[model samples]
Target: MHKILVVSDTHRKDENFYRVIDIEKDVNLIIHCGDTEGSETQMQQLSTAPMRIVKGNNDFFSNLPDEQEFEVWPHRFFVTHGHRYLVNMGSTDIRREALVRGADVVIYGHTHKPVAAEIDGIYVFNPGSLSYPRQEGRKPSYLILTIDDEGELTYEIKYLELF
Candidate 1:
């Protein structure tokens, strides 16, 4: 079995950043959606499994890739910062990319709002913002994905309510 923790749009605050660190022991991967800004350096300080980080529009780094595609647990996955794809335009932008990559899952960040949906056999997840969330009636959150040995995929949304 393999597990992954996905988060995005952390901005700069570190509060609750380590809320899901426990997954490091059981998960095979950690994925950061984007908008990390200075939080990238902080993430580097963490002790956990491997991580894949994409670059968001607000990210100041010049070296990070705008998007990334990879496979895990025999499943193809696509991740993007979402600026170039212009996700704000519509879901079509991301849906097209997912189709092109032939990925089973697509993850992106922008708009600082959380959403998860599946279309045409492809699953798309956005963990919203951890440091600065734009959505109402909730705290910052992230996504936890579990892929069992049988290839079944299960996902849960984890949020921080730390006051």
Candidate 2:
């Protein structure tokens, strides 16, 4: 099995970011959905997991791609920061884009809220914000996506306090 850690909108917070990385040390992959607030520089010091990062509206000087695609065995994931797709209004545009990219899953973040759903047969998820969470309970959160050797998928959102 492979463990993937997904996090977003860290907004320059270091303590929580470090804690999360430390806790998920066994993860095989790490995806940061932007708004890192300058924390990307410290990523080399954070964890040993392989990482993928996309640019967010707040990541002004970053050279990271605005979006990208990742293929893990039988699944293809479209990853983005969600700002350009107008996620605040709704995910229709984003969903359409992911479909066009032949993605089986879509991961994005921008609203500082966690989301998990299957729209039009594609899984769409957001890991929420590690620095600012706007959802119910206002807990800092992230996502753990586990993919077994046979390609079975299981994903769960985890709050910082509970991590």
Candidate 3:
């Protein structure tokens, strides 16, 4: 089984993001949807797992790609920061782009709202923001993706309990 951690929109304040890395120490892969605000290097150093990070709207000088596509065994994932796709309106545009890329799963972050749903046979997920959350209750959130040996996929959205 492979465990993947999905997070985004840290915007340079990484306290909660750091906490998540500590909590999910055994994750096999780390996916940062975007908005690291120039802290991608430091964040990458915190985990031994290979990481895939993209350039967010806030990362003007970053060299990361706008989007990335890769395979984790039986699943193909397309990762992006979502601003270019206008995701705040909805997932329609991004979903179409993902379909064109032949991705089985599309992951993005921009609205600072967590979403987990299967649309038209494709899995759509956003882990929200670790620094600034816009969802109700305003909890920092992330997503845990698990792929079992049988190639079945499961997703769970987790919120940080701030004290």
Candidate number of the best TM-score: 3
The true-versus-predicted C-alpha distance at residue 91 of model 1, in Å, is 1.6
Which of candidates 2 and 3 reaches a greater TM-score?
A: 3
Please give the lDDT score for candidate 2. 0.88
TM-score of each: 0.91, 0.95, 0.98
Order the candidates by TM-score, highest first.
3, 2, 1
**CA lDDT, every model vs. true structure:** 0.80, 0.88, 0.94
Model 3 scores a TM of 0.98
Model 2: how far residue 74 lies from native, Å: 1.0
Candidate 2's C-alpha runs over 4 A off are none
Across 1-163, the per-residue lDDT of candidate 1 in tens digits comes to 8888888987777656676675335767889987878577668678377789899889876467788899876678999978787887767888888998898899998977787878878888888888787778767888888889888888887777758
Q: Over the stretch 94-147, how does candidate 2's per-residue lDDT look in tens digits?
A: 999999999988999999999988888888999999888999999999999999
> How big is the positional error of residue 116 in model 1, measured in Å on the Cα after superposition?
1.5
